[model samples]
Target: MNDLVCLLFQSHVKMITPMLLKLFIFASVYQECHGEERVDQPDPHIAEFEGRSVTLQCKYKTTSPQPELFWYIQKENHFPKYMLKRNKYGGEDNDAQFQERFDSNVSSDSVPLTIKNLHVSDSAVYYCVLQPTVTGNTRTLH
Candidate 1:
């Protein structure tokens, strides 16, 4: 009777071991798949005439207490260039080349890019990024 009882216990342990391992792997994958930060650019395409002013909208969600937002511009056949950065704590930095016309203000849920005196050369793809970002695929306009 004792032998039978021992065999049953061993079988139960063997069955549960694999199940526990699978559960652990799943939890790790789930944690990695979900993130606490995201950014949205509602208007994928925007058009404005030369010398006109335009505001590009960017909305973001983050769990961070002090969120920092960034703007990047990618012209045709070139790498993405950093345009500016704005923090929730009233800090800001703008690249020298873009200082004259490019500006943004970080609000509670958004940081909009305002371009004054738009030029033909200003035509390009824009990106809004959040700090501590996750790696993912992004599409660029061709």
Candidate 2:
């Protein structure tokens, strides 16, 4: 099933920029698929026109039992700004900045970040950190 998930995701990437599967991890605590292998993570870059909106997708191939995903934005020369600091369940968090402009949602293994009312200040490098709910060592695709 994990392999199938990776396959389906790979096929989906065709419509956009091609994706390469560069990481494979074996995690034991994940109940989704202990021995299953997954791949074809999300693209690392996103370009959006000013005043427009964009959905940043973070997809990872893993059966991690309770992966709590966090999205962080780091502007050049500035510290990383975090979204969804506390309330992390579903729906948009009512407290970030600028009228709750940033909204996030998660799917099986992907989290799409939607930033509204884009501005020059909103431009930055975003990162998705998925730390399993269980404690364990971590490594990412190279």
Candidate 3:
């Protein structure tokens, strides 16, 4: 009985060892592919007159073929609010509150937020965000 139990345990270990190794390799490759993503807001401060238009620039570096870029606005003492998101494949969505005045286009490496008829309320910090694509299966078995 002791020898039988030992043999079963060794076989189970051998079976699981390859699966663990494969998972480690997959994780490393996933990190290597998705690790170097970043977004840049070139101008920390921008000034514009009321009732005019201003464009805020955001640049990004990503390995995703269909990168999704987003814009957010944050008021004083308030959390960031999602304004819009633009995809490389022409997909986009804008918040109802920003539909009229906020617009953007996704280019090869940058997305610029253009606010028309700027209001005093629009005087807040704007942020550019990047959403990286998921390349592999992300589900876990129970």
Candidate 4:
């Protein structure tokens, strides 16, 4: 009886071990192959405006397990504004700029930045940035 039990246990472990190893390797490869996505790859169209408000849109490509959405604004020869509104994990941080003249909605798949009460200063080009949960490159717009 003891010998039989020992043989059965050893067979079970051997069978499970290879499966576990394969699963681990597959998960690792999937992670490695899919990295942070490029939100503004090949550069999106530069929106031109002569109106009170402007909406800048970006099309992104990502296979991220988790994604965070953001919108940034930068005037000619000016630094960028890191504004966060929504994320994939459901965290919302309204930036000062957004608090003032911006209203937005975000999701794991898409981010839309709407600027209202636009002034001449706001005439500059805007960007839609997507920050994924995974540690990788940051995607930006112009």
Ten contiguous residues minimizing lDDT sum, candidate 2: 1-10
Clashes of 4: 0
> Any idea what lDDT model 3 has?
0.73
Return the TM-score for each candidate structure: 0.70, 0.57, 0.72, 0.55
Tens-place lDDT per residue, model 2, 12-83, is: 222222222111122223324553433233765556566677676766544556556666665555544566
Candidate 4 local lDDT, 41-136, one digit each (tens)? 233443333344545555555666666666655555554457655765667788765687676665545666666655555544455655556556
Q: Candidate 1 — which pairs collide? A: none
Worst 10 residues of 4 by lDDT: 1-10
Q: Relative to the unseen true structure, what is the Cα RMSD of model 3?
A: 20.2
Clashes of each: 0, 1, 0, 0
Give the Cα error of residue 32 in candidate 1, in Å. 7.6
C-alpha lDDT of candidate 1 relative to the true structure: 0.71
Where in model 3 is the C-alpha error above 4 Å? 1-35, 139-142
Worst 10 residues of 3 by lDDT: 1-10
Query: lDDT for each of the candidates?
Result: 0.71, 0.51, 0.73, 0.52
Report the Cα lDDT for candidate 2.
0.51
Quote the lDDT for 65 in model 2.
61
Q: Give the residue spans of candidate 2 off by over 4 A.
A: 1-41, 85-95, 135-142
- Candidate number with the higher lDDT (1 or 3): 3
